[model samples]
Target: MSQQQTTLHVELGDRRYPIYVGASLLSASNLIAGAIKGRQVVVVTNETIAPLYLDTVLRQLPDTMLVTSVILPDGEQYKTWQTLGDLFDQVLAARHNRSTTFIALGGGVVGDITGFAAACYQRGVDFIQIPTTLLAQVDSSVGGKTAVNHPLGKNMIGAFYQPTAVVIDTSTLATLGEREYAAGLAEVVKYGLIYDPEFHRWICANRDLLAARDVDTLRHAIQRSCEIKAEVVAADERESGLRAILNLGHTFGHAIETHMGYGSWLHGEAVAAGMVMAVRLSAMRGSVDVDLVVELEQLLVDLGLPVWAPQDMTSATFIDLMALDKKVIDGQMRFVLLNALGSAVVVDDVTEAELTALIDG
Candidate 1:
């Protein structure tokens, strides 16, 4: 961690953690090692990410630990029970006890699987989220939501297990493709739309900086998103009410992921398309102006995000898929809809006809 690096704290009673963000954080093994200060570490990553940053993270870890690694094939489709089992097998095979730490050293997919693995292994263990993807850095890696996908739905079986520390090295974002980077921006944008209007305006004003990956611009965006998410998580750890707000575009996004087949469209891509659909849905509710949809869609489009679903999925089919979102309670589909550009409302009474019209329109 450099002197210039900014730290965002997630104060949760005694289970508090810190999010470290900056350019060269990955190299600050001494600082990271000091925080966890443990003896047994298992860095869980994927084929794609392993060849890149895993070794660098392991090298930085304190000498007190015996670092082992389990590499899985990278992608959303791999975030499953069987893949999670790989970590369990490694932990068991390595004779690691409950004290063994798990490090998620990849994107959201790796972080989710690693976190869920940490939650299940020996009933639970400490894990560090070293998220490499833009999406993971801004959203998944910060929140305590960890899961493996069921054939039925995305993140259907998971736990709300917080990490010991969230080590976000923005330099890792350099490896991301154009589409992947844009996908992450969708999530970063979501935080502003849901809670901070000023951040939203900052995003709109400096869209070019974000698109070009300006260091200062990216850092602030990630920091704000994490701070907002951390606060919401601490208040409603189980997502009873407040935490559900974090799933603003997730309901529709999950549907896009499921219907399109996981891995075909990136999570951020699905969320981008999903957010556009949400704006249209909000417009139909008359809570938000039609221009909001136009603006949101255009921004995402200009960012190279997908603003529509695949042709194979019809409007009605998409609605049916959305009904299966994790946020649904008592068979009511709760939606986080924008009431204004910067504020949002949770409404479950949205009509299916309205959904079809918004999507089909």
Candidate 2:
């Protein structure tokens, strides 16, 4: 491990794992090798990422360890059963066993599918997350909520499998396009809105630094976001209770992703708009002040995130798509709403009329 690396533990009793956050972590071969559980390894990545970092990762593995690579076509549209089957094909063709470790070497799409593949392949296997994008580094890569998108809904098919470790290299953010980088700021803003108001304020204060990709600012943001998610996942690994708070904007966001088609609006972009919708709903229900909604919207806007659902999407369409969301319980849609700034709760009491009004108006 590098001296500058920040390590946070996701405490899940025996399933606990360390999240390493810092710069140049991709070069830490010992750190990468230490997390693997067996002699055989398969590094799962996408075509877009393989050309950039696959060789670097392969070189990190011990010479004695058998390492193979599976590179899938890049995009959210590719995150499906067919793509997952491709991963399985590679593993089966290589004759890998349960002891084989799967290393995810791209962003959230790569991490989610790879982790889900690890969860189902031969019942289960160990996996490592080397999240290269800001969105994955701050949120998706740390949580272990792995899955692929279904045409009807997002993450409807998935598991609660945990990773052996998460290695985040801030240097990777340098390669990200302007839009992708902005999308990540949405998830970073989520931790602040739902759990730490102070963190939210800090992000508001550091917008320029964050946009500029300042290393110190990103390291702190990634570490804090991981810390918040680690604590939540430790308490509720399966989204039974407290963990649902982490999905503050996801319910509506997933609906957008499903309705618009995956890869259309980035996950974080959809979530940013979804969060604005949630905040608007909260204000309509008298759960929070309208000023709070305005404040949150402005923050997201300042960070280059969309605060409105797409103009083409109807309220009824949102309702239809959201009904298929994973948060639905006993046929009732459960929404994560803010009780106040820095606090959130899941409620099933929201009426269809209320949601329709919120979406339409």
lDDT of each: 0.84, 0.90
Q: List ranges where model 2 is wrong by over 4 Å.
A: 1-3
lDDT (10s digit) by residue, model 2, range 280-342: 898898988999889888888877889988887877887788777778887899999999888
Residue pairs with backbone atoms closer than 3 Å in model 2 (clashes): none
Candidate 2 residue 243 C-alpha distance from true site, Å: 0.6
Give the per-residue lDDT of model 1 (tens digit) for 233-337.
888888777777777888888888888888988888888888887878878778788987887887888778888877777778876887777777888988888
**The candidate that achieves the highest TM-score relative to the unseen native structure:** 2
The TM-scores of all predictions, comma-separated, are: 0.96, 0.97
Please provide the root mean square deviation of candidate 2 (C-alpha atoms, Å).
Answer: 1.3
